[model samples]
Target: MEENKNKVVELLKQYMSTPENEPSRGISYLKEAVFILNGQGKTLAAHEILEKELRKFHDNSTVEMAILLNMMIKLSALVGDFAGAVEYSRRAQAICEAKNERELLTKVIINTSGLYFKMKDYDKALMHANKALQMAKRNGDEINAACCLNNIAIIHENGETGESGIPYLEEAVKIKEKHGMNAELPSSYVNLAELYYESERKAEAAELLEKARTIAKANENEYAIVEAMKYEARFLKGEGDLASAINLLEEVREYHQENGNKTELLGVLNDISSVYELMGDSKEALNTFKQITELSRSIFKEEQARSIAQLESSFEAREKLREINDLAEQNKRLRTVNEEISEKNNELQEMKAKLEEINRLLEKQAETDPLTGLLNHRKMKSVLDSEISRAERYETPLTMIMLDLDDFKSINDCYGHLKGDELLAAIGKLIRSSIRKNDFAFRYGGEEFLILLPSADMQRTTEVYSRLKESLREHLEIAVSFSAGAKQWKGESSDEFISIVDKLLYEAKAKGKDRLETSEAAI
Candidate 1:
């Protein structure tokens, strides 16, 4: 390795020392140096060397220069300087267009589309990807065309079209398989598996996922292996093996965290949190949520710093241009620079807005029950505390009800878990629609629910229960009923109040199912 590094250093020096008029002569040296550095996993070092040396030959528009810029584009993207990568891509693209270099131009367009995809500008990404696909097809570049198809499918999968991109991915996979493109098969298989899973084709998803894993293992492709594991973890969770799912995700989380992959780490942490929630470990879930929030803030800060650095670089370049131009041209250049600055500012604002939106969604997801779409028990405590305080302050009537589905276990046994889940979802929807806007409902636990009705007396609470029962029978096909307990608050602790209502529910269940027992009736 030491010998290889020394040789790379020598090659870079030779490339830098080559005369400006013979830029093509230096291209071999630069390419050799890059190849060596990449083998050593020192791409950042290679990028720095090339970027510093290339400064002296800015006037050269040779194919060599375009090649160097393209290399820099890939390096910048790898280092997470997407804005810089895009700038390099634009420069290379201009040279390719001017020279009518069709092959290199297609490659540059494909790379630009990938950069835009990373930047989350899906419209521009899709546009450039399609353009590259057309060019690749026209040139009979089957491999590049297959890659373009994969990229286009990914864009559609993530974009606002609400389309799964299954068709595009299928075509890409077929082409690669026909050509025996083993190097590319793993990724295509993984992508197709994800789409199949989303489309509810679990059997196909499992087959493709296994194929992806096997091929990735054979190729020693660590990235594809990890990707396959993530989906495997998801399948495990869906199968009710929460412990196995958590174990798989913990491995993925450690890998991403060690690699400093914040985006992938966030995803792993989210999956872990979900598994913890499923296991009824709210403490661990909450801790994971805190980690996610901290990591998200860290990513946002880094992005802001990168944007500021780019703006500073842009300012320096414009200053240099102003120094060379006449007064009139300088004025025109300043106007252009101001416009660019405005656009960048707008972009920053948009990024901030997006980050805020993501945080909002994360908070919502943490509080929500995934199966029933109701507030989960983790969110219930805080809401109950707040409502209790409000009721005390305003001297308003407050009531609580506990409802448990009658023979829910039998339902799960008679009709598989999927049918049980569907029934639960239907019941949750009915409960939500039956309650007043001011009332709060929660999926307290398996086969159980809790409703808090503020400013409602015992009679009103009973009426709400009656309405829910009626709605369930009217809306559901299967015969379903619940035993419920209702009570008006008597200035007791929240826990004590809940316990009393729970006992009342048991009393109703003891007497007969599908009935409501109220404090007023007992009195």
Candidate 2:
């Protein structure tokens, strides 16, 4: 490790000393250093170096900048910053498209597909993956073609179709093996093993898993090794070898934790929890669940911090630009005071527009739930209060629905909180699309949502509920149902209104879930 660190330091020094005009040469050195650092499991270090170097290149359209941005996208995704990765990918995609850099564009598209995959947007993921595959095939880029195939296969595997990805993955593995792509072999093998296991071809699955482990070990690919082990542990658990599965998962968890790979660590912890549950160790399972929750929160907080840092950096850049403009105005004052005033006014207008845009983004951030993209609890109270006031004053009917996911805890317990979050996000999108423009939806809290409909009584509100149910049935990949309580406002305070609806929601759950409960009396 020390030797690798020294090698990285030397490479970075060489890169820094390279002439500014020869950016390609400098980027080559930087890439080498990054490769070494990432191989050492120092991905954060690699990202930091890339970010520092990226700031030196002001022209985003440059090939060097696009390459650096692509690297950042991958590292950000690895570190569980899907939002940041998507932002970087968009910039990279724009640059590549404008420059007609198909090579970089293919990379960007594939990486974007990966980001969507991690976020569980299977439809988009599949779309992008297939697009990248076509592009790769057109360019006769065998390696990228194989990668695209692998991505597509995984998307199909995890998607709602319950279709086997064996064909796609088999093609990918064959391509890699034919090309002697040893580094890529293990992942393909492991993925194939998973499909084999799911198909109940246990012998083939075990053989593929062992091959993956052996190849990964020979390649000294720590990530691939742990990935292979993860699946092996799953197979062990499925075979009822609970003790061995737990031990293997613990080892996998240690590796992810040591590498600061929080995303994979979350998966490891979830697997551990599942194993414990299988072992009938409820106490241990709950403890593991708590750990997953805390780790998820930590990852969320880190992403938030990075966002704030980016905002601060943007503000600082604008401030510097303003200072430079002011200095130019002072120099131009000798020529004409009016001209200076006019230019200064124009600059002020630009600054005002920028500030307003920033304020809009900040406001949205404050009001929206990060996971679900719905109005959060922070905005819920004020919006509800205002709507209630409007309804009372105009004598228009207003209805609110409080809905909770049925068997949400079991979903979380069975599939982990990450899957639960995906379900909630899907439901949030469904609710948004199901409601009218005048209606409002908020992620009231965990596994619960609130919707407010203006100029609508219980009947209209029930219609909205029916629409949501139908939408969920058509769009959702998983089987999920929500119980809701809808009630017409009765000239009461917002708190009273919400309380009444909450009680009805509980009544729906008590009367056997997956149905709507509403006040039967007329307004």
Candidate 3:
């Protein structure tokens, strides 16, 4: 015991000697001191030391101060100093309220509720417990809500009523069960089981205790398992099952021994001895009682050491939980960053689509005549060359048609340039539609238009020219007409055919306007 005490003191000195950065660091280290001193059955000393150390903090560290004060409240109550505990709790509550720290205030309310319960002030206890329950519910903290319900149940359990506490305990257990809170299941089950046992509901009590035992076993909760087993044996003993009760206690005894739970083993041995006495086995009962007496002296030291081990184990779990929470926060921030990047990518894609559409319009403008919206000389000349090559390769019959508006320059001199441009655009659209689907048309020069008609003889070429002259008179509502020249290809290259067609057009114009001139092939 002295050696253990020295080690705890050494840790305390190390903590105090270290430079404090965050207030939580100092509070966490001091929690170790409080746990050690409380386990050593020195609650009063723990309270004195914690009170003195906490007072040294400046007023700025309210959260740390409030937490340390709440710890002091629990220790003071442990040593039967209810007045001191109440004072500490009030001070802590004021700090929490001043800072509007609702989460911390919920814990403070729970502690204050317990303090009030210890002081036998049931009204204050119920008030604070209910407030804590509401706050926990609002915060979505299921564990703290269960704790609040359990506090409310404990407050009712101390009353003279028979089963007033049962409903609250059941509610706490229901929340724990619904949320899969295995850690809180065993104690809540035991509390409700005790109520049922007192009311002579033996079956229900046994069932509850059995459930608690199964859950504890599945969770690997050694402490919860022992507690459940102890209650179950008592339940069985009350129902006149002494043999089974002794058997169960012996199982518990072995579990305690194997797990180094000497403190629980002492209780189990006592229970076993009691069952033996009830069975009228006087010699065995006496022997077991002797074993318990011999074990009692060492239990104080062993119990303290075991408590320190439990605190250390609990601390490790808390540290693991803290690390998990930190990782979750980082993941949340990363997701936000990824979403922002995705939004920027979408915006860039929209801008890129707009740029591509602009480039397409610019390319179209480069290939077309701006005034007439027709393929100009450069572009349609390529089309004429391609068709001439195809006609020669396939030995297919093709024709060329050249049309010119009769007296076009005289009309342009008579009208303005805008009217001449309109006339040219009108003629351009007419020629494009007048040609066959496989034919190609071009604005060859100032007032001349060229059409390359594939698989067309002279008769087909004359028909297409007549269609254009009629369309012109209909849509333009003018007396303008075309002097047309049509020719069948007789193995002539594209340039020679175009020259022959233009000369024929001039002959038609010289003969008379509104005439068609064709080669001997047409005749």
TM-score of 1: 0.56
Give the clashing pairs for model 3: none
lDDT of 3 at 315: 56
Worst 10 residues of 2 by lDDT: 157-166
Please list the C-alpha lDDT of all candidates, in the order they appear: 0.81, 0.85, 0.76
lDDT of 1 by residue, 1-523 (tens): 6788799889978977988677688877987898677544455576677767666666678777887788777666555566667778988999999998988888888888877887688999999999999999999988788888999989977874433366688989999998988768888888888776654467999999999999878866565677788889988887789998898899888766654555667778999998999799999999999999998787667657867866766757779767756465548878788889999999999999999999989998998898899999998888788778878876767899999999989888989899999999999898998775456899999989999987677877878888898889888987888998888888889898888899889888987889998754552
Per-candidate Cα RMSD to the true structure, in Å, reads 16.1, 15.5, 39.7
Considering TM-score, where higher is better, how would the candidates rank from best to worst?
Answer: 2, 1, 3
- lDDT-better candidate, 2 vs 3: 2
All candidates' TM-scores?
0.56, 0.60, 0.41
User: Per-residue lDDT for 159-243 in model 2, tens only?
Assistant: 7533346778999999999999988899899998987775456799999999999988887777888899899999998789999
Q: Which candidate's lDDT is highest?
A: 2
Residue 430 of model 2, lDDT score: 87
lDDT of 2: 0.85
**Who is ahead in lDDT, 1 or 2?**
2
Off by more than 4 A, model 1: 1-79, 314-523
